[model samples]
Target: MIHKAGRASRAAFRQADDEAFGAQQNGSMSKSMPTAVEAITGQNWQSIFVPKVNCCEVAHADRAAVLVDGANYFSHLEATLRRARHSIFIVGWDFDGRIRLRADQPADISPPLGALLRGLVEDRPELHVYILVWSVSVIHGPSATAPALLGSPWQDHPRIHMKLDTRHPLYAAHHQKIVCIDGRVAFSGGIDLTVRRWDRNSHRADDGERVDLDGTIYPPVHDIQMIVDAEAAAVLCRMAAERWSDATGEKPSSTAGKNDDIWPRQLPVQFRDVSVAIARTSPAYGGRAEISEIGTLTLDMIAAARTSIYIEAQYMTAPAVGDALAARLREPDGPEIMVVMTHTSKGLIERFAMASNRDRLIRRLAKADGHDRLRVVYPVVPSPQGQTQVLVHAKLIIIDDTLLRVGSANLNNRSIALDTECDLAIEARNEADRAAIAEIRNRLLAEHLDCAEADMAETIATEGGLIAAVDRLNVKMRGLRPFSAMRSPGPTRPIFGTSIFDPVRPFRLSLPFVSRGRSGAWRAPEKEL
Candidate 1:
């Protein structure tokens, strides 16, 4: 039986859907689509960003750019780090001290990350560096935990502080990847500063540059990051400081007055003078309330899409998100939906836990795709050894050129409610903003389809929709391929169905000898066995 509150919530969502699509039913929405200005500043179209509901805040950015792959993101990050003066904050799920920020540069100039940070502090006496990483990274992450737990030469400086965060609930990870320099510039997205996450946009299968510190070669990968300046940077700085304080019980000095013009000169700007929203996900623990702003914002963005919804993600096992998408697919005149994900999970544990669950969700969505409006795919690139998949590690979404989101959250149960995450979003304010957003979306699709951005745009225009364009251009050796649902073996089926390994909330442990009364008070069992 559905609870009263659940019924009311469904009703509210239905009303919102009707209001958003009413014009289409009257046969005028196609001709009367809201202009960019009207969608952003007018009351007729309710904005998807609502403070304390879907996002923490909406702040203005002087400039913002999308970094498509590691080759682009790392070089720009290296340049921006060189200009830091007062403070730097690095927060992530994992971190490697041996990785070079600028792999193309010589070792003398672009040293390992640890050496570079030490050099920066030595050269600038006023500068301080702080790094926070998840405590459980030692068990399952790519970075070596020995140096992080014990002291190393790079971590000996008094001005440099590194701490492992253990404040999350059991099985939940601290998954935000953020970097703020002097409160002037900030980066937030899926690309982590660790092993097996660096690759060029070309995604060449045998690229010589894709090697780890131990000389182990890795397969091609794909990810994204976003850099922003002005008020947006300051907001991210504050958020990082708060996380640092929550973990270590020591608040670093405020970065209020150190905002200098430190935007990377070489990075191209995607939007100027646009508003950006910061969304987060933190589970309830230790008296702190749960915050699922990113989850709520994703649903709202899906509900508001008028033409298409594009996504690239690492996993696709979030029940609520799958249900919302299924509902959208059930609509007769609904927007087209496309999702690009990894072809296979990485390790044995990931295969057992995530892969099986992913197939289940895909099957559910397929059942609800009555209008043929859904396409789930994986990207593959040509290799001399045959075709190899470009591992998708990006968390991105584009909704009808009206919204763009990039973040560290995966499309999984933990990211929806249990894990910690941070996502940056931009809502198009005018025609220029809309065009910029569309260009980024097209650029990503072009990279996947192994074509030029101009060609992608022309094909989409010619074919009348994204699905048609993809079909028309996906004949090359390197292109998108559809995903097929897989059935797990007998032994693992029940384990995956229980969802114990991928719980959506913190584990609640209770002793067998105790019982909870109707008033929520713990007491001894009336009849003990």
Candidate 2:
């Protein structure tokens, strides 16, 4: 499934008898993690749901802007930098110059965003640019995944001296995406610019040659992104500066990527009047580990939505979070929930820590959906070998269109509690703002379902949520269905709630461990039920 650079083959996700994603990490079970209530009951989870940013004001909060996904956000960001009048700065878990912003063009010209900066520097002398990637371990397991052949092209770029962040706890990463142009617009989401991630709205699952990463076609990938202005975007820029300094041992200049003529070159796109918050999840360099802002924000968001919660993500594997969602859905008046993500099978990387947890994960979400308010799904690609392409790699959420969360975080244990994730949320406090958010959410759904936004809204209204609407559509048009998997029927043993209260997540001593396919190490993943 490397996509391009090789023949397309459909191989079943074989259950490796060996451990997945490297070596076994042995630590003191009793003292390593934090405590959690077995049940986030009526009152326990109530405090977290309140809107962090009150969006109820009637005046026009800045509308009409773009919010980019971290994965591919950098592509258009170069356009932002070329157009800046005041400043330019960035933050993320990993920043690779080998990734071309305009992959469709020549390498020397589009050698990632860094070279473009050098080129524009002569034309627009006022522009300044900065970048901050995570300080992951040379440990390699969950840290960096750069392509070997391309080499580090950004290293030599004049305007951009990329800094790798090392200011984090033992088990965490600096995972946030921010871009500010003249301090007017910003973007936040999960898509990254590495390899094998480029695709149009067609979402061709089997077509790997379309969205090429390194000039050669890769896979049928997809990403969710947005644009924003002033209010939220400004905060994101500040966050980037903090991280930039943390990595470089120097502060990001106020005029990092500032240019005058580039502003008019890029159109100022608008979405909705949504209030957003920018937060980080980095613990002290070591000592008592703690979940970052991203995790806290998710739990808080889950508790806030009154009607429904719809999410689009790349990966999914968090048990306490799954349990929290489940506990919420049990409420007679709890909001419905729909999770859309790629279905990573018992892959070599995921099997170690999550093998036993998969069934539990699926079953928990499934059982929650059984109540008619919650469901989990993944994008699919049609192929003769019966293989499915679950490549919805955008991390976003539309909560009743009243709240939108976009950033570099995934809905997994690693992202929630381990990685440094960042997101920008828009709170549609008024009727008009809510409508605009709804409009965009439906538009995105239309792209996925291959329909018009108007039609998608009607479907959402008809079925109550996209998950139900998709189910209803599959029932009627079985053949037109994209690749997908519905929530399974029941709970699996050793599931999130099956055991007594343990201060920390239950880690298995017997489960097999393995390193990532490219390396040789170990991590935790699900085993058998």
Q: Cα RMSD (Å) per model?
A: 7.6, 11.7
Report the C-alpha lDDT of model 2 over 1-529, residue by residue, as the tens digit.
Answer: 0001001000100010001111012211111111121223453332222222211111222554433332334456666665665556656555554455665456665565555655655566555566666656224422235522233543454555566676664445565655556556666666544444545565554454354443454445567655666556555666677667756678655733333433324444445554555644444333434434555556556655677888777665554456556667777887877776655544554544454454556575565554677666555555566534645668887777666777777766556434566666666656776777787677666665666678788988987776677666543211123222343444343333212111122233335564343455565544211
Per-candidate clash tally: 0, 58
Clashes of 1: 0
**Candidate 2 residue-wise lDDT at 350:** 51
> Which ten contiguous residues of candidate 2 have the minimum total lDDT?
8-17
| Per-residue lDDT over 1-529 for candidate 1, one digit per residue giving the tens place of the 0 to 100 score | 0011122233343343333233223422111111111123333454567778778999889999999999899999989888898889999999988899777678998899899999999998888899999999877798887887786799999999999999988888999999999988999999878887778999998887788887676888999999999999999999999999999999897565454578888888989999999999998887788887787677777766778999999897765566667777887888899999998897876886688767766776777688778889999999987899999999999998888999998877677668999999998879999999999999999999999999999998898889899998999999998887622222211133324666666666645547778988876543201
The Cα local distance difference test for each model comes to: 0.81, 0.52
Q: How many clashes would you count in candidate 2? A: 58
Which pairs, if any, clash in model 1? none
lDDT of 2: 0.52
The alpha-carbon lDDT assigned to residue 81 of candidate 2 equals 60
Cα-lDDT of candidate 1: 0.81
